[model samples]
Target: MSSILHVELAAEPAAAGRSRRVTGRWLTSLCGAEQPCATAQDLVLAVNEAVSNSAEHAYRGDPSGVVVLHGTADGPRVELEVSDHGRWRDPPADNGFRGRGLDMIEAVAEDVRVERGPRGTTVTFCGTLGQCSGTCEP
Candidate 1:
């Protein structure tokens, strides 16, 4: 059996928090009975980072952009995809702070994929319940 959820929000800082909460609630209802709390938390964190990146970089200085979040739970794994219909920009050089969202997403997710094109950018990540023990290879 598989379950899926989707949400669309304005590309803004506040939307990141709202996305996180919605994703967390969906994951809890879908996996909380069997998946570990830590696993769920990790997945939620990854989604949060993805959304934050979109809000911060994808549509920089523009709040009119849109972000779409899709989540699916199948068997023992959960997959999330966050997409923005805006041009992509390279992460800025670290001057002391910032530029850690991608790193943090990779750390928490068992699998991560990023794609950019003229139309938009999409980040997809997945995590397994009680399965991963070490760093997940690309």
Candidate 2:
């Protein structure tokens, strides 16, 4: 079985929390009664990092910008894409306190891809559902 979800929100710091909540609910529904806590945590963390990066760096703290999140659950795996419409910016200096979002995302997600172009940056991540190793038929 397959399930999908999409969401778009203002590129504001506050939107990050809202995005996490929405995504978590959707994931729970798609995963059915399996309750894959670890997978859910990883997916939420990855999505939050991607969204936060757009709100903080892409728009440079401009809440007027926008962030788009797309999710797909195919069989035993789930994929998520988070995109922004603003230009991409380099991470902060090593000594900076907030340059580790990408690193944290990479650590949690099974696969991570980042693309940047004139229009903006997009992050795509995927991982297998904890309770559905071969298929997510429920």
Off by over 4 Å in 2: 34-36, 130-138
* Predicted candidate 2 versus true structure: per-residue lDDT over 36-86, tens digit per residue: 366776789999999988887788766589999999988768899999989
Best by TM-score: 2
Error of 2 at 60 (Å): 2.4
Residue pairs of candidate 2 with colliding backbone atoms: none
Residue lDDT tens for model 1, 1-138: 238989998988898899878887776666544333667778889888999888888887786899999988777677899999898987657646877888899998877999999989999998766443332111
The TM-score obtained by model 1 is 0.85
Query: Lowest summed lDDT over 10 consecutive residues: which window, candidate 1?
Result: 129-138
Window of ten residues with lowest summed lDDT in model 2: 129-138
Best by lDDT: 2
